[model samples]
Target: MSPVPNARVLFNAIPQGVPTPGQTTVYDSSQSIDLESHPLNGGFLIKTLVLSIDPGMRTRMRSTEEKSYATAFEIGQPLEGFGIGVVLRSENPDVAVGKYLQGRGFLHQQYFVLPSLPFGMFFLDRHPALPLTTYVGALGLPGKTAWAGWKDYSRAKKGETVFVPSGASAVGTMVIQLAKLDGLKIIASAGSEEKVEFLRKLGVDVAFNYKTVDTRGVLEREGPIHIYWDSVGGETFNAALDNAAVGARFMECGQMTTLNSVGSHAITIENPMAIFGKSVSIHFITSFLIIPKHLEEFNRVVPAALVAGTLLRSPEDVRHGLECVGEMIRAVQSGETRGKAVVVLGEA
Candidate 1:
């Protein structure tokens, strides 16, 4: 067979803040395998289908000297993230050709070859009822993140009022739906009017545009929140801390608000006494850690819930082709995307 044309997105430069087009570049090339000389040796080649664009990728865009939970993307290397792919050729008996799987190391590439299925990699159990993109959105890491926050950390109960910031976000959207299913009264905040409406449709008891409203006043009106699922940190997080009910649980999921900011900014609480007086329990969640610890529970629950319609799948805002990846990442970071921003490479 002739060499297959391939294209991939490369991390070209370190970003000062939010990444731009110059920081990432698309490289086109061709790949070929010699079947006789290098017959399948416990490896597989996959056709990239859908790529997941996440805010967490920003942290990786920085230099390795800057410590973070994940390793930084090396300059001139392919930018890596979660993506869904179809196995095009396989030497490994465990992985069959034509099967779909979700894993890391997805660049803006047409085809990728892996020596072996890496840790955290799993074959996607094709569900006729669910769209393929849904696996990359809700039923993927985002949904699992929501599950970990509510079930393990927050321990939200029925009739309790739970406040969630970034309610229109990939993880936050799932958080709202899951909280509602668990019978909790949800108060959610978003950046735009459209997102506020989206949260309401997702069954949040109250939805507000945090950009326009006074978060403290909003919390005061809804007072004594039993749990706060904080996806946006900074001032919004401080507000949640201030108004938390006695014994309220606070789950720190992500700090999307100031994630792209270059330098340190003061996010001090005016009254630390409020937290001390309430005996609020605060738990910081790193979903990568949580996902592995609770993989069994997630595998057991999420699929069934999805099939039963108990958990609504988050919407996927897909940008077609590998070239659009940089712009998609920017849109996600800038709060321009209504749902989970994904880059669709090709058909299933």
Candidate 2:
């Protein structure tokens, strides 16, 4: 076969806060495979099928040289995140052509060559019962994050009230469904009435528009919350702290508000002493950490729940092609897209 034409999105520049179109650029090229010249004797080439657009990518765009949990994207390089793809060429004995796989490090690219499977990489089990997109969304990182937060960290029990902010998000949606399945009473907050209604339909006991409602007041009325699955870390976090029951578990997932801040503005809790009074047990959760620590449990439990229909899979907001990635990222950061924002590269 002739060389494959490839299109990719590159990290053009670091952004001050949320990434804009200027920080990323798209270019086209072509690649050919040669077994003798290949870097990995047993390597494979794959066609990108679905790329995930996550809010966590914002942290990677920071210009600072100091490294956090994730490495900062290099200027003039393809920006990487989670994705699902199909093998187009393979030399590895364990892997074969036409098989689907899931892993990180995919850009908004049409094709990629891999020497070996990276950490957390696995062959996707193509069950006709499940959609391929689910491997990148509910059956992927976001689902595992929720499972780890609820099972390993929070340990919320039956009849206990669990509060989840950003309840319509990829991670939050799973948290709500899992909490409900565990027999916990769920109080969820969303940015819009539409998302609030979406949460209600997903079986949350109480769903409210955090943009308009007085969160603290609502929590005070309906909660002595046993578990607070916090994804939005601004006023909502403080509100949850204020309303936490004694011995409550606080799972800190992400700080979206501070991440999206443009300048020197920072999020500060007015009443830091609130947690002291309640004796809240706080656990900061990074999903990457879960992969190394709890991969076994996550792989066993989450997929079962997904198959059994106990765990609700959020609808995807899929944008077509690599060119739309910047706009998709902006929409996710601005809270314009509902559920998971995914970029479908092309039909596999």
lDDT per prediction?
A: 0.79, 0.80
Model 2 score (lDDT): 0.80
Instruction: Please give the range of 10 consecutive residues that has the lowest summed lDDT in model 1.
Output: 29-38
Query: In terms of TM-score, how similar is model 2 to the real structure?
Result: 0.90
Supply candidate 1's per-residue lDDT for 297. 85
- Candidate 2 pairs with clashing backbones: none
Root-mean-square deviation of each candidate, in angstroms? 2.6, 2.7
Name the weakest run of 10 consecutive residues (lDDT summed) in model 2.
Answer: 30-39
For lDDT, the strongest prediction is: 2
Write down the TM-score of every candidate: 0.90, 0.90
